[model samples]
Every structure is written in C-alpha cells, then in structure tokens.
Target: MQTEIIIAGFGGQGILFAGQLLAYAAMDNGLETTWIPSYGPEMRGGTANCTVIIADEEIGSPVVRNPQVAIVMNRPSLDKYEPLVKPGGLLVVNSSIIDRTPERKDIQAALVPANDIAEQLGDRRMANMVMLGAFLANLPVLSIEAIEKALQEHLPERHHKLLPKNYQALREGARYLAEKV
Candidate 1:
C-alpha cells in the first residue's frame, strides 16, 4: 500500500522536521519513502510545507497533487490544502492555531489542539509531533513504535534529551483521536 501526506504551516512551525520524522519512520519500517520540502523567501514566518510519500515499492515521483493525508498546522495551510485532500482520505488539523473548521465532508478529519497540547505538556514547539501522532493513530500507515525508533536512531544526539517529552506529546495527540472541531 502507499500513502501520500502533506504537512504544512509557517516555516518555523517545524513543517520540514515533521516530514523528515515521517520519512525516517518509513525508512525504519523498511518502506520506500520520499520527502520534499518547500518554503517561501520570507523565511520563518512564511509559508512552508512538505510532501511525504511512503510505499512498499519504488516511488515514481515526489510530487503529489492530491495527498491521501494532510496535516495542516495553521489557518492558511488548512485553506490551501483542504481542497486538495483525496476524498475518503484524512485531514489532520491543528485546532489550536486554526480558527475555522474544515468545510470538506468527504474526507476524515482529525481536529487536534496541537499547540495547546504541547503547551500543556511544557513545550509549545512540539506541536508538530502532536499532529503527527494524531495522523498515525487515525491512519495506521506507520506505527508509533517505528516513529519512536526513528527518534532514537535518526534524530540528532543533542535532541535525544527531549525524546521523552516528544513521545508524550505524540501520545497526547493520539489520545485526541477523531475529535471534531
């Protein structure tokens, strides 16, 4: 099976990092994966997004005009990607940053309060992890165990100290499940 995902938000919101984490997990699971990152010249506060494709066979391309999953971390990302999700796919929304609910009903939606959950867990920057957690829980394309291993094996050594907190954030986001906004 194959799964295509897009993670998007402002540049500083860890959009690329989140996609990298997914790629790492896919690799750890022995799946073929591709991660492509994009951003605007405005830098940190500007638009940033990444596409991740995981499959059992060689991926033909990194470009995905319509993804099976979209993890949008902000209002603008939501606006841009909502219409692009494939019907019957999944849309993970960061309710903490997005003010409006999704208008599409054909796809499954997970409204996670990522920023709020991260803040409650002691760090607001882990919102990306939270959203990723929600996506994994709902879709099952990649196991959380695989992601944890990726964190331990692939993430930089200096960041290892934050693993516990990051794991907690992931769990908390998963716990949210299919909550509606």
Candidate 2:
C-alpha cells in the first residue's frame, strides 16, 4: 500500500523535521519513502511544508498532488491542505493554534492541541512531535515504537537530553487524539 502525507505550518514549527521523521521511520521499517520540502524565502516565520510518501514498492514520483493524510499546524495550512486531502483520509490539526474544526464530511479528523500540550511538556517546539503522534494514532502507518526507535537513533546527540520529553509528547499526542475521537 502507498500512503502520501503532507505536513504544513510556519517555517520554524518543525514542519520539515516532522516529514523527515516520518521518512526515517518508514525507511527503518523497511518501507520505501520519499521526503520533499518547500518553504517561502522568509524562512523561520514564513510558510513551510513537506510531502512524505511511504509504500511497499518503488515510488515513481516525489510530488503529490493529493495526499492521503494531512497534518496542519496552523490555520493557513489548514485552509490550504484541508481540501487537498483524499476522501476518507485523515486530517490532524493543531487545535491550540487553530480556532476552528474541519468542515469536510468525507474525511476523518483529529483536533489536537499540540502547542498547548507541548508547552505543558516544557517546550512548545515539540508540537510537531505531538501532531505526528496524533497522526500515527489515527493512521498507524508507522507504529509509535517504530517512530521512537527512529527518533532515538537519528536525533542528534546534542539534543538527546530532550528525548524523554519528546517521547512523552508523542505518547501524549496519541493519547490526546484517542480521547478526542
């Protein structure tokens, strides 16, 4: 099976990193994957997004016109990618920063207060992990354990001290979404 996902948000919100993490997890799980990122010239505060595709066989293209899943971290991203999600697909939204819920009836949605959850966890930067966890909870394209292993192996040594919180954030995200649904 092939799954295409899009993660979008402000540049500094770890959008690209989230996509990379998914790619890494997929690869480590013996799946084929591709990660492609795009951002405005403004960088940090500008809009940023990435596309991740996971499949059991060779991938033909890196560009995805429509994705099966979308994790939007801001309202602008929600507006842009919401309609682009395939019918019956999953949408994971950062509820703490986004004021409203999704309108589509064809797709399932998980409203996660990622920023608030991460803030409570002692770092707002981990909102990406929260959102990623929420997505995994809904889709399970990659198991949480797989993701944790990928993170432990790939995250830079300098930031290893934050592993506990990050892992907590992932579990919290999954837990939060499970309850919300």
Candidate 3:
C-alpha cells in the first residue's frame, strides 16, 4: 500500500509537525516513508507545507504531483492543493478558517473546524493536531495509539508535559469527524 499526502497551512500552524508525526508513525509501523518540508521567509505568517509518502515497499520518488490526501488548514492551502488531489482521494479542510468548499467532485472532502476545536481545547495551536485527528479517522493506515507514540518521538523531552493536551486534541478531532460522518 502507498499513500502520498500534502499538509499545508500558515507557518505557525504546525503543518510540518503534523507531517513529521505521520512520517514517524509510518516508520514505526515499519513502512517506508519520506517527508519533505517547505516554507516561506515570513516565518509565522508565511506559507508552510510538507509532502509525506508512506508505502509498504521502497519509495521511488519524493515528489508528489497528485497526492492521495491533502490536508488544507487555510484558504491559500485549500486553493492550492484541493484541485491537486487525485481522483478518489481525500481532502481534509480546516473549516474553522476555510468557508469555501472544494471544487472537485471526484474526491472525498472532510471538513473539520480545527481551530475552533483547539480553542475549545484550551489552546489554539493544537489546531493542527485536531486536523491530523480528523484526517486519520478516515484512514486506517495507522492506529491512534501508534500516532500518540509517534508524537512522543517527534516532540522534544522538555515539551513532554504538553503531550496530554496534544493527545486530547487528536482524539477530539477524530471524534468530531466521526460524528460528522
């Protein structure tokens, strides 16, 4: 099995972190994976994105022209990547910020109000994890437990105290999506 995913949003939205968590989880599950990140110069307000590929076999390329999954956390990201999703692919949108719907009709779109949910969860920054939860709820590629474990690996030791909040955010997002579906 192979999956190519693109996660995008503003620089401070933890877009790269989400992609890194997914990559780490894939590796933990013994899958071949690649994560490539890109960002603009404006730092917090600039655009940031990452491409992650997870496969059961060796990956041949890091470039993803048409991703199987696209997680869009902002209007610019949605506008840029929504149409690039392959037919029958999944488009996960952070509806807390994006009100517009995708133009494509061939793919499945999951809308999660990630920012709002994160705010409710007591921290707006966890919105990325909320989006990640919503995205993973639909795909059985990795278990939630695996993702939590991967999160530990990606976060620095000093930040370990915040893991519970992040874990809760992930579960909340997944629960939100499950209810929506």
Candidate 4:
C-alpha cells in the first residue's frame, strides 16, 4: 500500500518536523518513505509545505501534486492545499487557526484543536505531536508502537525528556478521536 500526505503551514509551526517524524515512523515500519520539504522564498513567515510518501513498494517520486492526505496547520495552508487532496482522501485541519471547512465533499476532513490540546497537556510545542497522533489514529498504516519507537529514536538527545509528553499528547489525540468517532 502507498499513501501520500502533505503537511502545510506557516514556518515555525513544526509542519516540516511533523512530516519528518511521520516519514521516520513509516520507515521504521519497514515502508519505503520519502519526505520532500518546500520552504522556497517562504522560509520566514510565508507558507511551508512538505510531501511525505510511504509505500510498501519503491516510491517513484517525492513530489505530491495531489496527495491522499493533507494536514493543514493554518488558514493559508488550508486554503492553499485543500483543493489538492484526492477524492475520498483525508484532510486534517488545525481548527485553532482554520475555522472554515473544505468546500469539497470528495474528501473526509477532521478539525483538530491541536494547540488547545497541547496547551492542556502542558506544552504548546507538542501541538504537532497531537496532530500526528490524530493522523496515526485516522491512518492505521503505521502502528502506535512503531511510532513510539520511532519517536524515541528520532528525538534529539537534548529533548529526550520530552518523549513521554509527546507520547501523552499522542494518546490524548487518539482518545479525542475515539470519543468523537
């Protein structure tokens, strides 16, 4: 199986980091993965986006003109990439920033209050992790155990203590979805 996901937001929102973590987790699950980040001239306050591909077979390209899933962390990202998701695909939106829903009925969408959830969990920085957890819960290609292991291996040495918090954020997201669904 192959899945293409695009994570887009303004810089400093951890959009790229979220993509990298997802790619790492996919790789840890023995899937072929590719992560392509596009900062372009928008490196500062402008829009940033990353395309991550996870497949059981070889990945042909990293560029995702139309992705199967999109994780949008801001209004611009939601407005910019919402049209690019395929039919029946998933669209995960950061509801704190984007109050509007996608106009298309072809895709399934989830509005996650990531920032608020992260803040309640005691670290606003784990907003991305919360979203990642929701993504994992919605897309079951990578197991939670594999994602936790990947997080342990991928987190920087200096931030090792944050792993448990991140894990908690993930669980919270999962629980939120469970309650909603």
Candidate 5:
C-alpha cells in the first residue's frame, strides 16, 4: 500500500517534524518511506510544506504533486495545497487558522480545531501532534502504538520527557474525530 501525505503550515508550527514523524513510523512499520520538505525563504512566514510517502513497495519519487492526504494548518496552505490532493483523498484542516472548506467534492475534509484541542491539553504546541492523531485515525495504515513508539525514538533526548503529554494530545485528537465520525 502506498500513501502520500502533504503537511503544510508556517514555520515553527512543527509541520515538517510531523511529516518526519509519520515517515519514521512508516519505516519502523517495515514500509519504505521518504520525506521531502520545501524549505528556504518561503518558509519564513509564507508556507512550509513537506511530502511524505510510505509504501509497501519501492517509492519512485519523494516529491508528491498529488498526495493522498493534505494536512493544512493555515489558510494559505489550505488554499495552495487543497486542490492538489488526489480525488478521494483526505484533507485535514486546522480549523483554528482556516475558516473555509475545500471546494473539491471528491475529497473528504476533516476540520480539526487543533489549536483549541492542544490548548485544552495544556500545550498549544502539540497542535501538530493532534493533527497527526486525526490523520492516523482517518488513514489507518499505522497503529497508534507504532506512532507513539516512533515519537519516542524520533524526539530529541532533551524533549523525551514530554513524550507522554504528546501521546495524550494525540489520543485526544483521535477521540475527537472518532466522536465526530
């Protein structure tokens, strides 16, 4: 199975790190994975996007022109990448920043109040992880346990102590989606 996911947001929102975590989890799950990030001056306040591909077979390219999932954390990101998502793909929107919905009818969009959820979790910075949880719940390619393990391995040693809180944030986001769907 091949799944291509695009995550976009402003700098310092953990958009790239979220993509990396997904790729690492895919690798830990014995799948081939690649993470391609769009960095540079545009990433300052404009837009930062990363494409992550996970497949049971070999991946042809790390860059994704059309992804199976688009996780957008800001209005600019949603405006830029929403149309690029493949038909029948999932679009995870951070409702805290985005007010509009995708115009496409073929794709399914999930508007998650990531910032609000993270605030409720006592750390607004975990908004990315909250979105990741929603992604896992909708995608179902990897288990929550695998993602938790991947987080533990991928986070820096200094940030290791916050793993449990992040996991809880993920669970809260997943539960929110579960209740909705």
Candidate 6:
C-alpha cells in the first residue's frame, strides 16, 4: 500500500516530529518512506508542516501535492490542507484547537480532540502524539510497537523520561477512536 500524508500545525506543535516518527516507524517495518518538513522564518509561532510518504516499493519523490491523508492540528492547517486530500482520503482533525469542521464529504473525516486528550494526559504538547495515534488507528500501515521503538530511537537520551507519557498519549488517541467507532 502507498500512503501520502500531510501533518500541519503551528511551529511549536511538533508537526515535523510527528512526521518523522511515522517515517521511522514505516522504515522499521521495512517499508519505503520519505519525510519532508517545512516552516516559516518565525518558527515558534509560525506555520509548520511535513509531508510523509510510505510505500511498499521505492518512493519516486518526497513532495506531496495532494495527500491521501491529512493530520490537521489547527484551523489554518485544516483550511489549507482539507481541500487537498484526495477523494475518499482520510482527514484527521484536532477538534480541541479547531472549532470548524471539514466541508468536504467526499473524503473520510476523523475529528479527534487531541489537545484536550493531551491536556488530560498532563502535557498539552503531546497533542501531536495523540493525533498520530488516532490517525494510525485505522491505517494499519505501521504497528504501535514500531512507533514506540521509533520514539525511543529518535528522542534524545535526556528526554527519555518523557517517553512513557508520550506512549500514554498515543494510546489515548487510539482509545478515543476505538470508543468513537
């Protein structure tokens, strides 16, 4: 299977990190993967986005013009990428930050309260992880074990203490979808 995804949010929201984690997970599973990150000059508060492509065969390019999956964490991201999802594609939205809903009906939409879930987990920054978990719930593209391993491999040693919380956040997101569907 081939999946092209775009995860977008403001700079400090871990948009790029989320894409990296997914790519690492795909690589761990022996799938071909590519990740590209983009951001404005004012990183901290500016818009940030990343494109990730996972496939069973060799990837031809890293850039994604029309993604099959969109993980939009904010209103602007939703406004920008919602229109770009391929028909019948999946759109994972963070409802905690975005009050609006998807306008398109041709694609599947999963509204996840990622920020609220992360807050309940005691760290709002983990919204990305929550959203990631929700997005992975139905994709079956990568296993949670692979994602956890990727986190362990990519996170700095000094931040290892937070791994458990991150894992919890991921689980929480998955749990949300389970209960919803």
For model 2, state the Cα shift of residue 164 in Å.
0.9
Q: Name the regions of candidate 1 deviating beyond 4 angstroms.
A: 178-181
In candidate 2, the residue pairs with backbone N, CA or C atoms under 3 Å apart (3 or more residues apart, or in different chains) clash, namely none
Model 4 lDDT tens row, 69-102:
9999999888888998999999988897787877
Q: Model 1 — TM-score against the truth?
A: 0.96
Predicted candidate 1 versus true structure: per-residue lDDT over 75-162, tens digit per residue = 9999999999999999999999799999998999888989999999999999999998899999988988888888889889998999
As a TM-score, model 4 comes out at: 0.95
What is the Cα-based TM-score of model 6? Answer: 0.98
In order, what is each prediction's RMSD in angstroms?
A: 1.5, 0.9, 0.8, 1.3, 1.3, 0.8
lDDT of 6 by residue, 80-148 (tens): 999999999999999998999999999999999999999999999999999999998967688777899
Give the per-residue Cα lDDT of candidate 4 at 175: 76
The TM-scores, one per candidate, come to 0.96, 0.97, 0.98, 0.95, 0.96, 0.98
Clashes of each: 0, 0, 0, 0, 0, 0
Output the better candidate (4/6) by lDDT.
Answer: 6
Query: Which ranges in model 3 have alpha carbons more than 4 Å from their true place?
Result: none
Give lDDT tens digits, candidate 3, residues 76-144.
999999889999999999999997988899999998999999999999999999988888898767878
- Residue-by-residue lDDT tens digits, candidate 2, 83-154: 999999999999999988999999998899999999999999999999999999999989999989998999
Candidate 5 Cα deviation (angstroms), residue 47: 2.0
User: Which regions of candidate 2 are displaced past 4 Å?
Assistant: none
